[model samples]
Target: MGAFGRMRNSLSFTPPDLQEARLEPVRRRIVFYIPGYDPEARTRYRLLFVREWTRYTKRFGGGRREISRAELSQDGLVQSWTVSAPEQGDGAETRYDVLLWDDIVARDFARSRFLSVALLIVGTLQTILSGLLFRFYRLSWKYGNVILYPFVMVILLAALSVAIAALVHAHLGDWFGHSLGLPLWVSLPLGVIAGLVWIKAIEAFLNRVFFWQLLNDWVFNWQHGQGRRPDYERRLDAFAEHILSSVAARDEAGHSTDEVMIVGHSSGGLTAAEVAARVLARDTSIGTSGANLSLATLGSGLPLVAMQPAAARLRGEIARLVTDRRIVWCDFHAPQDWMNFPGFNPLHDLKLRLCGQPVANPLVRSARFRDLLCPETYRRVRFRPFRMHFQFLLANERPGAYDFFAMTLGPRRLREQVLAPDAYSEPEPAVPL
Candidate 1:
């Protein structure tokens, strides 16, 4: 069998072997999950998680994994779900409280078209400059491709813009002036407006293919406040308070708190890291006192922003996260996902000159899509890199080393599963399957 064949076979479903995982005492759990640059309502994510969990239960639930319908909060920013199953030959219920931070991303999508276009121009230039510098640094061959693809796409867009302008002037100029009997001054401005409209339309079409909105947002935030948005800060504060409250409730009830895992996907990776850093900032003994705090950043785009020289504030936050021994940070990267910088290390890649002592904490691991999907499903979506990026949050087609639902809702704690001896590694891409 080839590598792909082996990967598929390895992921084939087997009866649930509860013995493979070390059983932990039943305790309350909390997860603060942040989605990518998405503008969809929180209900969308709620349904998505429900659907994925349902699929997981059908596949490997072994008629044991039972999940409750996700109950949305009145404010609609938080959702809570409960999962129960027999573990270690004992029946115990695990309460999974998930808080989704999504307001800022929706606000980003609601920006005026005029402002979006203006920011696009500025962001495009910034992206080109950053790409060139990344290539100059010789980070990786993949980095070169990342730089080349966007630069080439932008050039193509520019060429298309020029072509549309020329076509408008050629076909419409004479007709407007003579047949419509419009003066040259009036005709010229109309033609220009028509050309600009065509360009904007084409830009919108290209965005579906290249995801320019994410790039534009990243650049805008980096240049503006280095990924610091007031709404995001407010939400982060709320999340921290929720964590403390959950821990407090467990304490008052005389139950031990299991774990608090902050999961960030795509751009949410950056947000998750910063939020965890802030929580530590406010209370340095948070993880040490009660529940173990952990961070799982899946398909994170941290390098996209951190690579830029203007991302000083973000870098500072990252450096703080690195040295904080209380938090367990596990960064999962997939080589197949072009949306994230696979195998990139933020501290070394950004070349941070930190003011405080630096420590290596984030153990980079590979979330291989090949191992997660069936052969047919993997082959079908392998070429659709963007969809593959989202596979991080969805249920695995077949269980293997890493399962998102299992991490969040399974019997074992995040720290127990991820902090195992072979569960961590330095920043490096997993070998392609």
Candidate 2:
């Protein structure tokens, strides 16, 4: 049996029809994927994309001929990878060039014991205060849960600290008195050392729950001169310039660069939007002159940053993108993803109050994990909100509508796939009992 037939028989749900759109020769394509505040090596994301793409192609029927090794740019801020694949039918073979724009400033923040602890403490306090002042707790119960997570961690850590201190005092005190003939001073220092050790031991885990990177980036970037990270901003500018140059090069070579897509997940959403805005700022005619420019933001935590009063630059970027009708911005929101402000419109909610009329550039759409995953798998992960936040990148178990791999790797144009009148559907609210 063919791969498509086998995939069809093996799956419980129907996949989105990739053949719906007219098959065209895909000559050139560029996908710039900006990840959230993650310090892990870029190789991990490449592996993830390969795995998900392999699964998607196997299940949905396509062939990937080659995937290139990671090639780092001279500045070390950007990494590029390529994949060559054929369309489903007699369509053209496509080359997908993926660039990962990484600016993980939190890696340094996380390495230092004092810095990590300070940021976490400050981040926790800031989150609580922000929640109360902004009424984030009432805006969404998820924000309430986010606010409570740190306190819960604190309580757990406090209990653990006390227990450790008591254990050290009981056992080490006796050891010091009898064996070493030391005084009570030794016991106090020992207890203090033990507490510090405990905090260090759980630092990485604490980072995951509290999202220190996300919080720190938001707060730090809002500061004057973006916390002295001019390089970070410069890299973003370079990336935008590179994108425009690449598109122009492809066009000048007489190749049909069908689409240039900028995809960002979580905090990266804001970054992606900013990058697109920067491109527009550099070349006002980018969207109209060249290939189709598209932005796909998955589980965007844009509001978290844009809501801050200090985020004037980010707010301006968002405002520009929202007002520009040339760029197709598709914001994918999952109802179960608590990390992001799902179904929240940044321009409207942020109250940018533009002088001119607003254009509906971002067609906010709902990505339902429940429909994408099988019932058993869905139930297993329904309560795990963090995992669900990443479901946007994972391959669907039972496809209903949205397919991340298909949109990025398949033959269909992003506009043909997401710009349908019925494509952007409102998520159904729960029926009250």
Candidate whose TM-score is highest: 2
lDDT of 1 at 391: 90
Instruction: Provide the clashing-pair count of each candidate structure.
Output: 0, 0
Candidate RMSDs in Å, in order, are 7.7, 9.4
lDDT of 1 by residue, 77-172 (tens): 677777675454332365655567556666666677556556555665666665644432243344345434544665676677667765565554
The 0-to-1 C-alpha lDDT of every candidate, in the order given, reads: 0.64, 0.65
Worst 10 residues of 2 by lDDT: 4-13
Candidate 2 residue lDDT tens string, 1-433: 5321121111111112221343353445678888876656366677888787676655555544577887777766567776665533422234444445444554545465455446556655665665532444434457446645554555677788888976776666655445444457887688768976887787688666654554454444333223344656776787787788877787788877666789988867877888899998888777675466788999886765566666677787888777776677888877677776655766446767556755646767778788888788888988777688889999776554687866776555676666552443322222211
Off by over 4 Å in 1: 1-26, 86-98, 130-162, 175-182, 199-212, 224-228, 352-360, 419-433
Model 2, residue 40: C-alpha shift (Å):
1.8
Question: In candidate 2, residue 165 scores what lDDT?
Answer: 76
